[model samples]
Target: MERAMGISHFGAAAAACVFMLAQGARAEEAGPHLAIELNAVAPAETGCLISFMARNGHPAAIERAVFETVLIDRAGQVERLTLFDFGDLPAGRPRVRQFSIPGLACDDLGQILINGTSACEAGTLGEAACAEGLDLSSRTDVELIG
Candidate 1:
C-alpha cells in the first residue's frame, strides 16, 4: 500500500507539471504585441533624421503601418504633426525605418508621440492589430509615447 501511494503522488505531480507547461506555452502564444522603439536620432542637412526599430510579434504580417506622429518641442509645444509610413513589418521580424523632418532640429526635439494608427493593413487581421497591444520605448534623449 505504501508503494502504491508513492506512485500515485508522483503521477499527480507529473500531471501538474505538464499542466503548468501547457499554460505557459499558451500564454506566450496569446500575448502577441507590436513594439516600436526610437532607436536613433541625428541631424541631417534638411532637418532631423529619426530612426525607429519596429518589431511585430503577431502571427500575421503587417503590409503597411502608418502612424499619426507628433513632434513636440523642448517648450512642450507641438512642433509638427505628420504621418509616418513604416512600410511592411513581417511577423516575428524586426525592421528599422528612418524619417527626415525638414526644418526641424534634432536638438530642439523633446518628445515623439504616436497619436494613433493612421493605417494598418494585415489582411484578415484588421487594422486594429498593429495598434492593439502596442509597446513603445526610446533609446535616445527624446521621449517616445504611444
Candidate 2:
C-alpha cells in the first residue's frame, strides 16, 4: 500500500471503496431543492472530486452504482454531466457509508450540479440503496463533503 499523508493505497481490494468514497458524492436530476452534505470537493485528472454525506444516509455496501455529476449553468440549465467509470462492487462490506466524487473542484459549487445512479434502489434506508445483499444508505449524512 502506498502511504501518503496517512492514507494508504490498497490495490483493487480498495477499488470499490475508492469508487464509493471518491465518486458517489452527489446526485440530482434537476430540481430547486438540490441540497447535499458536502465533505470535500476537489478536482482530479479526469473530472471532479466530490465527497459528501447525503442528508439522507447511504448503505455501507452496494451492488452496482453510477455517479451523475451535473454542472449547472448560471441560467439554471444542465451544462455538464459525467458518469463513473467503474460498474460494481464485491460481495462484502465496503469502506464507505458516505459518498465520493473524483475529478471535481474541491472548493467550488457554483460550477456544477450533481446526483447518482443506484442499481439497488429498493430497501434503501432513508437515502440508502440496497439490492440482493448489497446495501446503499439513503440521505442522512452528518458531515457534508463537497
Tell me how far candidate 2 lies from the true structure as C-alpha RMSD in angstroms: 15.7
Q: On residues 76-136, what C-alpha lDDT tens digit does candidate 2 reach at each position?
A: 5554566542333333322232334444343444443335543333222322342122222
For every candidate, C-alpha RMSD to the true structure in Å: 6.9, 15.7
Note the Cα lDDT for every prediction shown.
0.94, 0.39
List model 1 lDDT by residue over 9-114, tens digit each: 9999999999999999976875887899999999999999999999998889999999999999989999989999999999999999999999999999999999
Q: After superposition, how far is residue 66 of candidate 1 from its true place, in Å?
A: 0.3
Evaluate model 1: give its TM-score. Answer: 0.80
